[model samples]
Target chain A: MALEKQSRAAFWVTVLPPTLWIAVFFLIPLGIVWAYSFGHNEGLTGVAITGTFDNYIRAFDPLYLQIFGKSIAVAGLTTLLCLIIGFPVALAIVFANEKMRPLLLLLVMLPFWTNLLIRTYALIAVLRTEGFANWTLAWFWNQGSTLAALVGLQPFPAYQPLELLYNNFAVVVGLVYVHLPFMVLPLYAALDRLDKSLMEASLDLGAGHLRTLFSIVVPLALPGIVSGVIITFVPALGAYLTPDLLGGTDSQMIANVIERQFKRANDWPFGAALSFLLMYATFAAIALRAYLTRGQPADGHGI
Target chain B: MDQLAQRTQDAAAHKPIISFRNIVKRFGSMTAVDNVSLDIMPGEFFALLGPSGCGKTTLLRMLAGFEVPTEGSVLIDGQDMGETPPNKRPVNMVFQSYAVFPHMNVADNVAYGLKIDGLPKDEIKARVQEALDLVQLGPLAARKPDQLSGGQRQRVALARALIKRPKVLLLDEPLSALDAKLREAMRFELSQLQQKVGITFIMVTHDQDEALAIASRIAVMHKGAIAQLGTPSDLYEFPASRFVADFIGSVNMFEGTLIKDGADEAVIACPDLAPYSVHLPHSAPGSAGASVWVAIRPEKLNLHKNASEPPAVPDCPPAHNVARGEIKEISYLGDSSIFHVQLSSGQLLRVSRPNRSRYEQEHFGWGDTVWVSWAGSSPVVLLS
Candidate 1:
């Protein structure tokens, strides 16, 4: 009896740290968010802790709804663009000849070795008005004017250089570039596992190349594609860095709004409520993805 | 069943389906398939038998259109297959690994080719059902590949390839994945299935027993070349070279230099055995000075009491081919007995005899003195 008691005590002792850590760090914070979602914020000074539905009601207002919709659209576009550009690159790396594959894979992962913010900043130097592209365009325009005077008609109209900095397009490009390797790595892993004979079998059965890709390759690779999308989409939905640096005032996302409420706006209760809403939205998207692919193997959980 | 059998009989009367002309395939620095030529008659069961890396699978793949020949042309029904892709070719293959789609159920797997060819829905369903029934997998049509046994999956692969009703069906080691007992049973079933379907079935396998059992003609390949191509009995009874004789089955070989050649007989003085004369189909007088290996199957030799006493025998044996040896060991398997004997010149010869009821009464144990001898026509002369 004494030995049994000592063994039971040892089991709990071993399990206590991780159990307490999860309860303290995850469950407690979630409970606090749940509590704050029901509470009302007082003006400026503090929040008067009381149960209310006003915060959720305000969250669904046109202003906030528009931001939420825009966030979804932007994140969806980013994910689609990443998939389009990443899949073929991943395929090339995976199917390259033995000696070249390691070098190609290294090139794909090289961008991730540096700080992500530094990489995004590097793009600013290339796309800005005073950058290399604009300088080349200016040089071409001057040459065209001189040639027009010599033999051609009037020179083309003087063009103001492209204004790409601090725009939603830049934000989208940045999101795709930053999140591309995440998408490609998973896709490479999945495509590498696919049987080469299956492709041969499809070709042997009278399906042409395009037909085989759509019918056999695409459907079989749906798991990997979905994983890549989730990996890019979920983080992109709550992204703040790219938008803060590249987007205009009108292009601010829900995550930027939440950040503003916590640090700049100083609305702790409202920020907590917004954070809970973001968490719920992410969870809902995951649940819906699971529900759609219910019976597929390895489909339920999002990466 | 009767209707299916009748259809198979009707299909068997068809003419030559596929032919090959000097096909060659190379991979970078290695020649996977050397220049090869063959013709596959309609509804014939043909086999390509060889060890691993012997280009048998490459040849099979070339016929399936998964691989294109580096040199010569392949024709299906006299149609040039050079420009034809695998799907357009009237051929289908059962892959070596049984490449059944894991996500698909048995019916869908069998129906894949029909659907890909844009068959009508009703026709696809009917054909899939027919194929499932043909392979005796009708009851498991709804189960996925992982849910079935290895043999069942192999049947599904076979059914999938056969349902296309192509002019030719290629199978690459279809029975290699099964256990010994199941492989034996499936070999008989596959042979019967081919006869029933009456498609030109070409299979590649390393197992000699499988080739001998199912093939109407077997092509033994070695080092990217066809060593011998003939009926199984022709190969077993009269192998053309030392490689074929040594590879096909268990045979006792004696190395010797040919000494004398006549119109019907040639004498070889073995360096390690008694000089013996062997009957030849034709005069090989110039081949006397060349080194040769004489081969005799273990079952052909008979055991006698004394070496010198057998100057004549009542069995109407051929003249001049006889050897005497002492039995060194006896191996008693249930249905037969194998005797390992040592000749006076220290060459060992193995002799196998059926364990008949009368023979069982006279058992030869280890360390027995016995004469091993065979008629002149029994041993095959191999020059390589």
Candidate 2:
């Protein structure tokens, strides 16, 4: 702070650009949406600031509340899945050879290079009824039936495709696929900063690799794990495209409901209210993270 | 008295606790440790002393089951540790960084090994208390490692490793991280703790003072091999090679040719001491006309400004131990002063004198002509 005070020009040069960018691009629009949440729709394109509580009251109704609850469940499950899968991926990346570490990290981040829509569509191509997944299952089934017939046993019946798309399971699969990099990158950052001699010390003290992983690695990585959970959970909770493209009748989340209010129903005020409620939940998760990492100077990586 | 005699006899007949038999370690194209063979006796405070990359730490790591020797085998307590992992080995290490678990408190850190052994909760708790009290850290058992001072954290590491009571305890540059004053204090503490535990402690250190002060035996490593292995005095006084002599402390190397190899004594004629020779009290190595080095420590030589002082030996006249030089320069250390004496042949020799007489009327300063002499046994001959 003293250095910044002395070099005021450099301080402003560094601080002004980011402050202006956030004010113009984020805060102003968010302020407008916040105002809209307190008002009601006046016409097809207009909203009046009457300070009405009707939109929030309507959001509390059981129908929308059920959607919010289901969204929370799906997002929680997705975050858990991402943690389970990303930990080994991050550990593998950390332990890779110097020449291969960057390449493996590049592979982890490759999915973000292309557009999300394109990737979702590609997932759809593989998960549809007559898609590549069913085709591979059918091929294996035919081979098994042929082998059964050659062994003089009755062959199996006709192959049936497993339901892989347009369900809550598909929504969760898509969210885990999309948000996995967020979890892995932060975990990699945290684990990479860990003092490796602690692991050696544990091993020298007669702990096996598995015990060391659970006792030493996991506790030390709590900050990263919590940050990764929040990053994955918040985005998965507000996911709109994955459910819209792949969800069934009963699989719609709160984001899908909010999208409908703004477009097909032409109710901007209620949509803004629901969006702010989701933001509030995100703020709560972030607050919880701040509380947990209060005194720890070793922050999560990539958070 | 009889029991003490019997105990000594038993110790003499006992087998070595740790032995490295011709061990060689290669990291890709680089050989880190090369055919290093040494034996550490039971309950000995052994030290592997060397500079960085001298393979001292590598050898200790191999003993701890952290690295596998590429060529030879390691045996601890007569058991071949070929397939043993670190956890199954009978040795534990206090890491150089004192790698205490940051997430766990001191008591929990000390209890980690006991928990791994599946001891009951009560036993683990009791042992943790015992270990912490052993290090005089029982009061701070609830504090985290980050909250402790550097010396306290090192004590924590010591307790954590010692709780397991492994047959051998390995320390890798243990005091290298502490401040000089703290390091000196910890040196005695570590030595006392090792004796109290009565475990065979194998420590790797680059600091010669720490090795000399704490270790019962020191192995001076040079270029992936043990240059000399003996007690600290043997290494300091009777250095086997010029490397050991130069590495352990400051020494003056007077190059000369062996002029006479006799039965009771040998003499080396140096051009720097044209009128005097280096007389070895014992018959030394080397034939006539062969070049050899006479290494003498600075503190071993006595600097005198007057010619009336008594000689070191009567009738012998300290022959070949005396040299005539003018005091060229004086470096005034706090406790002692070093006199750089320029010989008649222009060779420089340094002699250190203690600041003993505070009330002396006169002192030897620069440009004072003096005779530097030592005992006949003060010089060590190095063949290489």
Q: State which candidate has the highest DockQ.
A: 2
lDDT of 1 by residue, B1-384 (tens): 465476457546654577778888899989988888877788789999989999999998887787889999988888988967888989999888787877678898899899988899999999999999999999999998878999998999899989999888999998999999999999999999998998889999999989999998899999888999888987898898888888888899988778877687677777666554544444553476788888999999888765446445334334455666678888888788889998888888889998878545666767777766677667787777
**Clash statistics: count for each candidate:** 0, 0
Per-prediction DockQ comes to 0.39, 0.53
Per-residue alpha-carbon lDDT of candidate 1 for residues A138-179, written as tens digits (9 for 90 to 100) = 789888888887886887678678877788988898889889
Give one digit per residue, the lDDT tens place, for model 2 in B253-371: 89999888888778888888878787776777888788999999999998766575534642243556788889889998978889999998998998988888876556887788888
* Candidate 2 lDDT score at position B322: 81
Candidate lDDT (C-alpha), each: 0.83, 0.90
In terms of lDDT, which candidate is strongest?
2
**Highest TM-score: which candidate?**
2
- The residue pairs in collision within model 2 are none
Task: Write model 2 residue lDDT over A117-182, tens digit each, in one string.
Answer: 998999899898998999999999999999999999999999999999999888989999999999
Pairs in steric clash, model 1: none
| Off by more than 4 A, model 2 | A1-6, A298-303, B1-12, B271-276, B306-319, B322-328, B342-348, B360-362, B367-369
Instruction: For candidate 1, give the lDDT of residue B235.
Output: 88
* TM-score, candidate 1, chain B alone: 0.90
